[model samples]
Target: MDLRIIWFWMVGILIIGYAILDGFDFGVGILSLFARDEKERRLHMNAIGPVWDGNEVWLLTGGGALFAAFPVVYAAVFSGFYIALMLLLAALIFRAVSFEFRGKVDSSVWRRVWDLAFGIGSLLPAVLFGVAIGNILHGVPIDASGTDVGSFLEMLNPFSIGVGVLSLVLFVMHGAIYLADKSEGDLQTRCRTRASQAWMLFVVLYIVMTIWSWIGSPFLFENSLQNPLFYILFVVLIGAIVFLPIVLKSGKMGRAFLISSLLIAAMLGEMALSLFPRLVPSSIDLSNSLTIYNASSTPLTLKTMLIIALIGIPCVIGYSVFIHYVFRGKIELTEESY
Candidate 1:
């Protein structure tokens, strides 16, 4: 296979890894805001405390891979989405800060303020990520030089916003299932109820976003329809969606969480299949699009990077597995707990 093609899929896998691992962390943070009391809120935070930062390693790795393998696309996207990315950065920073600072002070107001920060921080990224994907699918106004010339506000068009909401609902559902798995009694019941509610919303938004994407970005369907892998992923996505409710209803929280994670992976896989070689489609002119072929680094650079990635990615996987293994099972809040 071509090295560029290899790196393209490699980058896609890294992104999917990040989305699946850290997605529930965002969900848990958002759900923390709805906790009935301080203990419940701490439960939400502590559920993901150990693995959250480690899960984010996939994101950093994905970004580094993008920059290494597709410098032109990286440059174009980073420059175009500068302000939005800054907002995302700020949100993540605040969320991280809240984890530490919220526990330090005994004051209700201080903890409340940090709690709000954590919730908003999680909420913004959940929406923004979907919006970013929406814009990429809907196509951006990339000029001849391959830079996105569109204004920041243009990124928030109706279709993109709908996609953003869809993403938020999906994450909330994922988080609720995870929380349900990690709690017992009243909290678990509440988490299960939230998961079911979020599932309903996710279904509605999924249908709406599909229709909107069909209307706004018909080109995405063209390649996807022709690819056999798309059909396979589509089947898995639908199956996961269908079985999620059944598992949730049966109180199989772990299975429900697994189904939700599969749902996320399948959805992202569908997006990758639709995108194929195109990294950033140009609204101005399709010919100006940045594709895997057009935007990739030199062959030697790709080869060298592939060698490094081969050795490094497994280490990340091993560490992630080890951390999760150590932190597995229901959360038990102790004096040292977040």
Candidate 2:
């Protein structure tokens, strides 16, 4: 296989893994904002407590994979999106600390403060991630030197913000499904209700975003449409999205959650297919855009990395699977719980 293509898919898998795993963690945190009381808040926190950190490792590995496999793209994205990435880092730090410190104090005020931090921390990253991807999909202002010529505020156009809102809704729904899966009693019922609401919101926003992308980001479909298989995938994507709510309403939390995860994977898959060859397209100079051929490492280097990945990735997957299997049940708050 062409290592560039292989690495591209590998990197995409790592990102999808992060989105599927930490996506729900971020979702849990976003949902935590709506908790009725400290008990409800703790239920939200503990829903993801066992797996959030482990989930983050996929992102770290994805970064490393990007840096190693596609150095030029890494340099361009990291430097061009420096401020955005830093904000994500800051939010992640604050969010992680909140998990530990929120339970340290029994005071309602202290818990409330951490709750606020946790919610904002989780929410910002989800919105910003979509905004960044929106910019990528919309094309960034990359000059000859591959610098983002656009100002920071310039990055926040209506389309990008709409994409951000779409992402937020998606995460909220994803988190709701997870909460429904991992919570109990009134909280579980409330989570299921929230999931249904989030799903309805997602359908509306998904339509709007689809219209926007069809108009503004038409390139995403142009190449993909050349292949008939893309249409099959789209059908599958729609089917999964449609089937999710039915399963949720049936009180099958595990099945609903599985469908949600698959739905996320399908969405990511579409993005990957649409974004193939070009990692980041440029608005200022199309020729300056980073592509797999222009942005990747040498073939020998890629082969070595693949060998390493073949060994390392399975270990990561095994470890992640093990963690989930160990924690596979509704959360019960104990002295040891978050």
Candidate 3:
């Protein structure tokens, strides 16, 4: 009913959309480094090629929504996390170049460089994204004017670093599961093994980070738990985590991968729920925090954007689904292929 709540849903949907879509693409890149050979790596790349760029549209929309609908939150977040965001942007650029140029250059040396770039690029975003979220959860230092006046070092604390690694590992695992489902032969087996290994590490890291995050900054969990919906989302996430390994071990790769995607969605949903109202949690006081009320655009702007988004998002999603369905199944690297 309220424009503020509408804006909240709009931003939340886009944020989750980006995490679910680009997330696997990053995972594919992580797996590329461990692929058995060039051909295997090519298969990994091919599996994501048809939709990777399209998947990125979700990210663009998410950023656009923030800038349009919630300018204050956008300003504070982008400025506070400017350095980290810049690094992420750079990594994304390198990743795009690595993807395009890696195949064009026939030389092994050139391809190797791209390969390394791809790995680093994937890793940096995965880790940094988690850290960014972690920092927000921990509450960044804000001044009397409600501006994000925190130092760079303050953002890179131990808690954020732990969350960063957790993000990287989680996405890598997510990618591996997708590859196993879409690929066959030696590469598929390798992906499964890698996914299994990543799952083990992810479980350990996720638990530790969750506990530490709550202990170190109880407000994140406490605020979230105050809402019944938050607990519901948490249960769904936990269930997905429990369900994934069983599906994988049962040799249902497709189902397992689908469940993995759901798990990612659930986890992101939990974080969003945890951080609701406060876009950038203030370490100082609740009154100083940037909530949906303080951060959103005017009601007229919000209403206009809502109408446009309702029309636009579905079209983008429809096309993405169409392409994904058309390109469903394992990628075959033939001489005729791009």
Candidate 4:
């Protein structure tokens, strides 16, 4: 296989890993805002407290892989999304601070403030990430220099906003299922109810987004339709979407959570399939687009990184699995708990 193609899938795998992992973390934070009281809120926080930071490692690794494998795409995307990236960064920082500070002051007011920060932090990233993916799929205006020429406001068109909402709803649903699995009693019931509601909304928005994408970017579908893997992933996505509600109704929260994660992975997989070869499509001129062949680092560089990744990625996967196994169970709040 070509090194560029290999690196492309490697980058996609890291990103999908991040989305599946931290995605629920964001969802938990957003849902925590609706908790009935302080104990409930703390329960939400403690539910993810054990693993949230580690989840973010996937994002860091994804970005690093992109930078190393496709410097041109990294430079262009970061430069184009500078302000948006800054906002995301600030939100994540505040969210991290909220976990530690929310437990500190003992004052209800302070806790509330941090709680709000955490929710907003989670919310912004959920939406922003979707918007970014939407723009990439929809095509941005890039010049011959491989720089995105579109403004920030231009990035938030109707389609992009719809995708953002879809992302937000999906994450909320994912989070609710996870919370349900980790919680008990009234909170668990509420989480299940929210998950069902969010699933309905996700289905609606997903349909709308699909139509919008077809009308706006028909070219994205051309390659995917011919690819057999795309069909397989699409079937998995549809199956997950259909079975999630049934599983949730069966009082199988853990299975529902797994299905939700699969749904997310399949959705991203489809997106990646659609965008294969092209990392960032150029609306102004297809010739200006950054693609796997044109944007990737040299062959020797890719080979070096592949070797390094082979050694490193498995360690990450093993560590993540070990952490989840150690923390697997219902939430048990204590005086020492965040």
Alpha-carbon TM-score of each model against the true structure: 0.98, 0.97, 0.96, 0.99
Tens-digit lDDT string for candidate 1 (87-166): 99999999989989999989999999999999999999999988888889889889998888988898888888888888
Candidate 1 colliding pairs, count: 0
Which segments of model 2 are wrong by more than 4 Å? none
By summed lDDT, which 10 consecutive residues of candidate 3 come out lowest? 329-338
Q: Report model 1's TM-score to 2 decimal places.
A: 0.98
Over 4 Å off, model 1: none
Q: What does the lDDT come to for candidate 4?
A: 0.93
Per-residue error for 129 in candidate 2, Å, reads 1.3
| Order of candidate numbers by lDDT, starting with the best | 4, 1, 2, 3
Residue 132 accuracy (lDDT) in model 1: 89
lDDT, candidate 2, 160-191, per-residue tens: 89888888888888999999889889988998
State, as a TM-score between 0 and 1, how close model 2 is to the true structure: 0.97
TM for candidate 3 is: 0.96
The weakest ten consecutive residues by lDDT in model 2 span 145-154
RMSD of 3: 1.5
> Considering only N, C-alpha and C atoms within 3 Å, which residue pairs clash in candidate 2?
none
Error of 4 at 42 (Å): 0.3
